[model samples]
Target chain A: MSDVKKFMYVNRKAPYGTIYALESLEVVLISAAFDQDVSLAFVDDGVYQIMKGTKTDGIGMKNFSPVYNALGDYDITKLYVEQESLDERGLTLDDLMDIKYEDEDDDWAEKPSIKVVSRKEMADVMDQQDVLMSF
Target chain B: MKLSVLVNEGPYQHQASDSALLFTKAALEKGHEIFRVFFYHDGVNNGTRFTVPPQDDRNLQESWTALQAEHELDLVVCIAAAQRRGILDENEAERQGKDGNNIAPGFRISGLGQLVEAGIESDRLVVFGD
Candidate 1:
């Protein structure tokens, strides 16, 4: 419980093509177990990680996109997708998977977990974090 | 101030490990305490004693080993990443059914928790990677 810092994981690479996305997710999952204030920011090609309809059957790889859905269950739900990256890829928030979590503070109200933010807003979040782990 | 260094790339293939080493050296010269250098992803390759670079070139692994010897640095290679990339320590090699270990001097294979600990304990966690 000591030395709990605001940890931010930056993901700027796409999934499946390389191992960065999966490895980043693994670390994020591990960080979640620590009860740290963890946030995951997806920019550049990384925004594709949360995109809906991620079909990996053609490539014969595990569809790790589902892991994003489980982030809420693990209490690691602050998922940020940069607006610039998503717009550059011709994607809107509707193209992303429906991720949500139940808030006990609000009598178990379910709220959307992913946040679509501007690059500036993402930068501000980065500045606020005590640690930044990029992948 | 205490500093933690994170290297996410391997040896000569990328500048990450090299940059991390140089940064660590400079930080030490400035009288800063290095809490730990946690190697993750492909960076675990730097811990292998099997790396034999050309005599003419700077041996990256040797540089790190020398740093560890000179300053008693905490160089930790993530066990999960190491196992995934075949950089096994003596005990890990035996447990994983390998013939022998190739972990370099001064570098120890540990779990990813060390990284989290370093991130928390150190004033700054500088990551050098691709």
Candidate 2:
């Protein structure tokens, strides 16, 4: 486990228009079993993937938004959201789903996983990663 | 340095597969060790042996197969993605009750864990995609 590499899944596409988001999520789920230091970054249209109240009934596609809530259980608590992308898209943190994780180091206290950061901070996050897979 | 390559786009429709192949070739030429080449998403299409591009145009699958044959490269096609895209090996074809398999030579169907392992073991995990 000491060899855990920093794996970042960069999401820059919309949820359903293309298969990128779904496929990227699939990889993330599979990666959870590896016990690596994994993180998910939401930028551009990818921000919509975690948006609150995403209903797919009319679109005839499976709504995978709820899966974000389960990521914390998979030991993937780092969900970095780009503020610039949300701002450009006229969205705010309130528009996103509330994803929280239980902090075992803090007496199992529940903590929010989504972290809104400026573009500069997002760049730093990308720079600190050992592996970057953009979808 | 040890490196791993991830190709997320299909052949012909996008330049990702070609870029990854060229990059891997160049890296090997420079004396770098390629740990593995993982094909995911539409990239699994690159492992299909049914592709027959125009005679004048370069056949990407054949190119990858030839390079793999020469270098003994570990070419992996993601099983989930391959199933979705219909790129199956002989074993998978039988397991899935399919009548045929079209996976190109030197390519093996595997899970996404192979990609995660590649990332963890390789010095650099270069992803070529949109």
Estimate TM-scores for all models. 0.96, 0.97
Give candidate 2's error at residue B104 in angstroms. Answer: 0.6
lDDT tens digits, residue span B1-130, model 2: 9999999999999999999999999999999999999999899999999999999999999999999998999999999999988999999999999999999999999999999889888999889886
Interface root-mean-square deviation, candidate 2: 1.5
TM-score of chain B of 2: 0.99
TM-score of chain A of 1: 0.96
How does residue A105 of candidate 1 score in lDDT? Answer: 85
**Candidate 1 interface RMSD (Å):** 1.2
User: Which stretch of 10 consecutive residues in model 2 chain A shows the poorest summed lDDT?
Assistant: A1-10
- lDDT of residue B79 for candidate 1: 91
- Each candidate's DockQ: 0.67, 0.71
Residue A109 miss distance in model 1 (angstroms): 1.9
Q: Which portions of model 2 show Cα errors greater than 4 Å?
A: none
Candidate 1 positional error at A59, Å: 2.2
Q: How much does each candidate deviate from the true structure in C-alpha RMSD? A: 1.2, 1.1
Per-residue lDDT of model 1, residues A30-116, tens digit only: 887788999999999999888898888888889998899889888887998899999999999999999998887899899899998
